[model samples]
Target: MSESSPDEPPNSAAVLESMTLLATLSTAAEVGKSVARRRLGRDPSAQEPPDRAAIHLRNTGRTLMDLLMQLALSRVPLDHPEEPLPHAVRHFDLLLKLRRAERLTQDMHQRLLSLYPEVSSELVEEARLLRNKIARFWETAPSDPDSPHLSDVLEQGISFVVWTRHEVPVE
Candidate 1:
């Protein structure tokens, strides 16, 4: 359809936001796959069984990839000031969880540290504490299915990762 045609849907700012979201999700998928293949040892015939560390790392990466895709699909431009913030916060939580798992891997953590110098030693310690808190929350999942505090914790934890000044590629 012609861009100027009245019958054509207007490609407003929201449409650009959707495109950007799609691109970010595509990049996340590529990064997640690379991390899994390298860290998890995709070769089925590998001599050693994947350790708990490997399993957790792979699971976290996979979860982040899924969450990123969900965020892409769920996003919309902030057209109305009164509207709730985008659910990208959930994706941020997943990213933070994956980052925690990455921290357990010395190489991965160091790579991230080099790339994001803002993650100081103190911040790393804080992340460890937050990880424990999230773990504790999970332990009481059944009892806290609708816990308001859980949502608040997740939102605050995710806000840090999501608001970082990194440029994620779009495909």
Candidate 2:
């Protein structure tokens, strides 16, 4: 792939959104792996449980937000669909808010690959299935796009993840 020069203009909004989402998904994957390690009960060097837990949880939230952004951007197939920028930004913001307290499950890995094979080199079907599940959840419990409740979930999830990380005793 050719790299654009610094003076070059931005690509279409959809492209930009896709790139952003990709970056976020990568981060989420790393955090998810950390969470998986915690799930297996590996203890880290943080003296306090809460502090250690908080660190893991924050990483998980950051990771999920990225994946969510990727999903939202992929929803628009058109090269430069009208309003792609706003929709992409809105979804990106929402994922950042839904931030989970726990790390992503192994299912996340399967799903991500299934959905974005170009990025994951793994089965895309897994990600596609997970994506569908999320779409269904939203369809069933639709909320105001601008509600703070979503962010609250992220905050709570972060705490939960951190606590779980602590539960794993040092080996």
Candidate 3:
């Protein structure tokens, strides 16, 4: 990937590759958005368009792509980690960008409480404890931290996300 001057255009392979990927993303987004339309379930004989869920799915796809791209491209605690992390040799969904991931843990905990009042206080506390564990996931330089594998919890979180991706009454 060659760097371009301010007056010139970038001719790097990365740029071309990104452009191609964006085109593909557009196609994929349309497919996902199309399926969400309300008219899809309608009888064709009755005559109607699709029943579109809403336009927000565009942001959904873009956000997912951004996370996927970040996960694929780099290792962490990186992309500018907070000061004082002694060891940062880890990269997976659970611990990637360890600092940011820890932050997201708290944000998600709050999001869950705001969205679902019925969510148990115990569960919220569990998330808080998990956040604390994550905060120290890479504290030790040459050995594992005190926390158990947080990826186990992340796996369940990812599973539930996938489950929600389906329509109601999943078979």
TM-score of each: 0.31, 0.31, 0.35
Error of 3 at 37 (Å): 32
Candidate 1 to native Cα RMSD, angstroms = 12.1
lDDT of 2 by residue, 13-127 (tens): 6576785887688678867877996888763322334334344434543566555445445455545457565556555554443333122533333323332323323233333
The clash tally of candidate 2 reads 13
User: Of the candidates shown, which would achieve the greatest lDDT relative to the real structure?
Assistant: 2
lDDT by residue (tens digit), candidate 1, 26-88: 569767876887686653223222243234434443454354344444444455545233324
Model 1 worst lDDT run, 10 consecutive residues: 162-171
Provide the overall lDDT of each model, using Cα atoms, as 2-decimal numbers: 0.44, 0.45, 0.43
Prediction 1 global C-alpha lDDT: 0.44
Report the CA-based lDDT of candidate 2 relative to the real structure. 0.45
Q: Write the per-residue lDDT of candidate 3 for residues 150-171, one digit (tens) a residue.
A: 4543453343333323321212
Q: Any runs in candidate 1 off by more than 4 Å, and if so which?
A: 1-118, 144-148, 163-171
Model 2 vs. true fold: TM: 0.31
Q: Which regions of candidate 3 fall more than 4 Å away from where they truly are? A: 1-96, 150-153, 156-171
Error of 3 at 148 (Å): 2.5
